[model samples]
Target: MTCFSPKFMAFCAALACLSGQAPADTAQGAHVSIELNALEPIEDACRISFLVQNGHDTDIEQAVYEAVLFDTEGRVDRLTLFDFGALPAARPRVRQFLVPGLSCADLGRLLINGVETCTGDGIPADACTDGLELQSRADVEVLG
Candidate 1:
């Protein structure tokens, strides 16, 4: 019982151009990261899940998850959220979906962010705010 949507990617794309003390660039493409999973065929074959961390230490209090589709031409097409049969909390929550032939790279990171939140100390002045993780197989997919 979780909420999902495709509109979240729009938010991530906007965060990409930002440059400040903390950069959301760890995601490799945008300020967000996409995680693809293989699930047992209990229901759908296209098992996809996403985990989004604030690329920066801006203190993201809440946000929603989504699935975004991209073509070979580099166009973005947002897909519909799966019918989990329940609504997710109006905050940062985990969500999963089942899409058809979503390939391996057609998806992007989930977008979870609080609309109105108090900014933190803007990261420590002396501490190196940059952090990163190795890109695993679950991170992305490429559509043919």
Candidate 2:
């Protein structure tokens, strides 16, 4: 299952894409961004692995659970529209999600957990707009 809910996740995704944040009262709070970078295709089981970035202005003290992908064909009931995990990286933080048996070919999105955090120390607080990026061709070659 993906973190984004199919029935309503599209609405959330749209808000995030337009406003750079989940929709108003999305339960994702404010002043946060999720950038789904690379979704590297894996042949064996999953379609691809992802690299997500979580950012805030301050620091993350408590642990918040988050998930990526949102939805898939068969993986829905198995997992859930939302996965649970903790955010270890605080502000000025960019964490990567390495989902083993998951794919991102169809969906250009990754999973992320956002429960607790403080403003990070990345220059101008607003300067950090949590963004995601795909793995570079060079990096993929090295990993391959």
Candidate 3:
């Protein structure tokens, strides 16, 4: 079963077409989905892996995404930025980041947040304007 809630999925779907750029958020739109694959706890950091899937027919030259992690106190504990380069069409790209001093239990929630930049075929792309999805597993693992 999927770890993401239906409400969150709907939110992502609704934001998927937030832009009006051609092939970006238009009817003939391009889309991307972000999923939290795994969270690995290291010495003083959390190794986060995100699976970015390009749903558009065009190649995504680059995409900058954010992962907002809330702490146990329900406050914004850490905000991490991740970049996925050369994401080919219709393929899932795995991007990993090491967040210092973050544990799986410390994470209260994960937000797809937003895309900072997107490019396609050497030109600017509105991939994120169409909004991207985010999901996290209920059962997260911890590793030393």
Query: What's every prediction's RMSD, in angstroms?
Result: 14.7, 13.1, 9.3
- Stretches of candidate 3 off by over 4 Å are 1-29, 122-124, 138-144
Candidate 1 at residue 46, lDDT?
49
lDDT of 1 by residue, 35-126 (tens): 33333232324465533334443443333333346544556655444322222111122346666655534445432212222223443331
Rank candidates by TM-score, best first.
3, 2, 1
Worst 10 residues of 3 by lDDT: 19-28
Candidate 3 per-residue C-alpha lDDT over 64-140 given as tens digits, one digit per residue, 9 for 90 to 100: 87657777677888777778777887666788888888887787677656777788764345666464545655553
Best by lDDT: 3
* Model number with the top TM-score: 3
Q: Please write out the lDDT profile of model 2 over residues 11-64, one tens digit for every residue.
A: 655655555333333344333343333455566334332322343433433323
Model 2 lDDT, full chain set: 0.36
| lDDT of every model, 2 decimals | 0.35, 0.36, 0.65
Worst 10 residues of 1 by lDDT: 83-92
Let me know the TM-score candidate 3 reaches against the reference structure.
0.69
Task: Please provide TM-scores, in order, for all candidate models, with all chains considered together.
Answer: 0.31, 0.34, 0.69
